[model samples]
Target: MKYTSYFFIFILLVAGCSDSELEPDQSIYGYEYFPLATGTYQVFEVTQTDYLNTGEVVTSDFQIRHEIAESFVSDEQETFIINRFTRANENDDWEYLNTWQSRRTEFNAIVSEENLSLLKLVFPIEAGVSWNGNSFNSLEEDTYVLDSLSFPFRLNDQGFENTITVIQADNQDFIVSLDTRFEIYAKDIGLVYKEIVNLNYCADENCLGQEIVETGIEYRQALLEYGAL
Candidate 1:
C-alpha cells in the first residue's frame, strides 16, 4: 500500500473517536439518505432564487455525484472518494453531461469530532459538487469553509442565503454570472432552503423578489426533479 495511505490512516486515528463521525453536515442528507454507511449513492441538489428584475424563476443544472466509501483512519477516520461528480442538463428532456470531459463535483467533509455535515447547500460547496485540492482527507484537517461563489440573481429571494462558498470553474469557460449569494443545492430537492446568506460578491440587490410564487416545480416535473434543480 502507499506509504502516504498509511500516513493518512495515522492522521485519522489521532483525529478523534466518535459515533457520529460519518454524519452529514446537512439535515437534507437524512431526507434523502439517512443512516448513511459505506457505499455508493446519489443525491439531487436543487435551488430556486428569483429574477431580481422580473421575479422570474431560473433553475440551474443538476449535479450527479457518488459517495464512495466511508472509513475511519488513525488520525482522521473519514470517508474516501471513489468517484467524482458530473454536471448534467436535459435537452429536449434528455439528460446529458454539461461537459464532454471529467466534470466531477466533490466536497470537503466537516472537520470535527462529531464529523457532522451541517452545511450542504450550493454557494457554500455547490451541494453534490466536487472540488480541486480537496481529497478524502480534507476533512481531517481544514475547517471546510467554502468562501467564494456567486449567487444567481434569478434564483434569489429576500431571504437569500449562501450555504456554500465556491470559486466555480469548469473545463471550459462558460458562466451565467449570478451574484455571490449563490445557494448550495441538492438534486431533486430544490434549494436546501436552510442556510442562506449574502456574499461579498453579491452583484444585485434584488436577488429574489418579494412577490414569491410556489412555481409548483415538484410533482409536476419528476424528470426535472430527478434531474436536480
Candidate 2:
C-alpha cells in the first residue's frame, strides 16, 4: 500500500510539471502595436515648417488620413495597401494624396513610403534594441533604436495606454547641423506621432555653437482620430 501511494504521488508530480511546460507564455511580443486590418484608418494633423536659405520661414498646416484599403499577396507574403488623403482643414474635402505599402514578417514590420522601404520596428519589442532602418532599401545605413517601450503617452487631448517610440536618427553637430527623427506608435493603433527635424545651424564665428537655425525643415504629425471604417 505504501509503495503504491508513493508511485501515484510521483506520477502526479510529473504530470503537473508537464502541463506547466506545455502552457504558453503570456508575454507580449508587441505585434499589436501596429495592428493592420482592412478599412482601418487613422487621421493626423500635420504641421510643416520650411526654413529657406533666404531666411524665409514657411509654415503649413493640414490634415491627412491613412486608410488600409486592401491587402494583396506578393511573393508568398501578404502586403497591405494604405491610401493617404489630405485636406487643408476640417471644412475642406479630403483629396487623394498618395499610396503607401506596409507589411509585417515574423521578425520585422516594414513600410514603404515614396518608394523608400524602411524597417520600422523589430519583433519581440524590447527597449534599447537597435536595427538598420534602411536594411531593405538602397539608402545609406540608418540605425533605428527602440528608445522607449510600453509607456503611457498623451498627445493633444488624447491619451494612449501603451506606446513605443522608435528613434530613427538623433545626430547633431552643435556648431553646424541637427537631424533628429522619431515616431511613436500606440498599442492597437499604428503611428500616433512622428517628428522630423533636420536643420542647419548658423556656423559663423558670431553664432558658432549658438544653435541658431540657418535652414532646413521641421515636420510633425500627430494623431487626431483613429478607428475602423
Q: List model 1 lDDT by residue over 6-82, tens digit each.
A: 99999999677665766656544323211223453444443434334344556554544434444444444444433
Q: After superposition, how far is residue 216 of candidate 1 from its true place, in Å?
A: 23
**Tens-digit lDDT string for candidate 2 (128-202):** 999999999997999999999889999989999999999998987667999999999999887999999999999
Error of 1 at 212 (Å): 14
Q: How big is the positional error of residue 165 in model 1, measured in Å on the Cα after superposition?
A: 20
Name the best candidate (by lDDT): 2
Superposition TM-score, candidate 1 onto the true structure = 0.26
Consecutive 10-residue window with the lowest summed lDDT within model 2: 19-28
What C-alpha lDDT do the candidate models reach, one value each? Answer: 0.33, 0.92
TM-score of each: 0.26, 0.88
